[model samples]
Target: MRFLCILVVLFVGLKAFSQDSVSVPSIDTTQHTKDTLTIIGVGDIMMGTNFPEDKLPPNDGDFLLKDVESVLKSADVTFGNLEGTLLDSGGIPKKCNDPKVCYAFRTPARYVKNLINAGFDMMSLANNHAGDMGDEGRKSSMATLESAGIVHAGQMSQKTAIFEKEGIRYGLAAFAPNSNCVPLNDLQGAVQIVKELADTCDIVIVSFHGGAEGAQYQNVPRTNEIFHGENRGDVYKFSHTLIDAGADIIFGHGPHVTRAVEVYNNRFIAYSLGNFCTYRGISVNGVNGLAPIIKVFTDKQGNFFKAEITPTYQTYATGVRIDMQKQVIKKIQELTKKDFPESKTQIDDNGLITYLAQ
Candidate 1:
């Protein structure tokens, strides 16, 4: 009995020693790094001019974004310029004394779902046509977007839009040379607003609807552009100044054509993304129809690492479609090279954007 007792004690001690000696592997927390955020941006979008039923797109807007929905959805955030008001028909239209020189776009409020379905996270309501039906129209449009859970900025009263995604906060401010919107000409005011937003957010994006319009206005003039006796802000100075003031990305649209892409101090600037989708009252011929979906990749701090350009176009009466001809891509490449000859950014034939070797 004594021998059996001593043997049991020895066995228990050995089992306890074996369990205590077992080693567990250490976890590598660094290997689980977060992914870089992707932002996709486009130019003006007008689903259809709803004032007249004939101006609306075919199929009751069922096929408005059939082809490019996937492209827009692939990014973490998608944005565009809301070129018109979302209001019910019947509001007094802004007087366009000369139809040839002026145009107004009013989309039905019900169609706001289309923008939401297209995966647009935000929009810049700072363009000339946002007030097509005046203040009532603008307010209705804002309410519609709010109801649809879409963020918007550009109005002087609501100059900044703040949101968060994936633990990083984003600030968006829009400026344009128009009434009821943040004035693009007020560089100091714009800078102050951007700086304040930057101080609070992890990323800041500044959008401006400046420069001239139409196909002839494709080039970035680097000076103040004048259209119809109105002083459009100097886009080149505005972009650079905003970046210096703490904006990570600058998206410029007003010229209904794609312009150069520049990288200034690790920040990306798309001078003009061009007209993405327009139903009626707008022309979509030649370069005017070239719509580019600019995909931007940035670090947590909002420093641009690379970008991609997917060329798209709008057909008469139809919505946006991907352009296989690569005309828009080639045009932007040419413009970037011509406009910023010393730019370190490179746009390849495949629409891939990367920084050239130092």
Candidate 2:
């Protein structure tokens, strides 16, 4: 038997960032060749910043994500966290309290093609660096993604992203505790946005850049996280509430470390995916480099199905590559069991994620 693979050339975004960027369409009840639909998601991806100077990936950023392209494209939809602004040049960098510790990310605009080549269907622009270059940087990043035909959400100007792929309509509502982004602290606001998407789209995938930072904060505190005098919001409550409000999958990041995953009400929630292709401005040492490419298989109605983990990692020199040791899988398994002891999902040593009924 043969099956056709449909690709939606969805160049969806707003010319001018606003609250009404991409509108949600009517519900689509279409299904493809199989009962399960694959949605691949990864953590923060900065590629390389040009802010405080040129720090592009090896060979000027051409071979950044090539090694993992095949795995990324294997899903019906692919997503990542766009950690910084995409612009060739000029923009007002945000003022930092201490310039000694501040880092601004401004990747070359041309590098957007790298994401397209890597099969990134969507991205989350709700991280701390979203306003690195101020308004100009944000606009450039939005326009860059639009030109690449990739959907992005999380910015206040573009709260939710709606696109169709393989006959299934997908909705993405992103949030963060940063400025210019849809505030993650507002639970009702997120619920409202996700509910709207759920009312219209077949699958609603939520992206959030919350939780505290660093390796020490790897564990889910299950309460409002405070880091350096900043309230990072309670990711535990946020994920569960959004899932209850119609979010099919919630991909969390911002801690710069891989966190536990939970299966709530038959929906998938990866607490944090960690750094994927971060070249500079942050450390990829140890757990920080654990980039788990999560391929979530969901039923036609977005109900949770078996998933797989393609463990991958990156460094300042090598970019993203498949991890032969499956370090990410091992780490996730350990973290998940420790954090969500009652979770119905079990991950095997071989990286297969299955739902177990009580």
Instruction: List the lowest-lDDT window of 10 residues for candidate 2.
Output: 1-10
Clashing residue pairs for model 2: none
lDDT of 1 by residue, 240-353 (tens): 999999999888899888999999989999999988888777888888888789999999778888999988988865678888998899999999999999989999998999
- The reply for model 1, stretches above 4 Å from the true place, is 1-33
TM-score of 1: 0.89
Error of 2 at 344 (Å): 1.9
Cα-based TM-score, every candidate: 0.89, 0.92
How many clashes does each candidate structure show, in the order listed? 0, 0
Off by over 4 Å in 2: 1-33
Q: Relative to the unseen true structure, what is the C-alpha lDDT of residue 140 in candidate 2, on a scale of 0 to 100?
A: 97
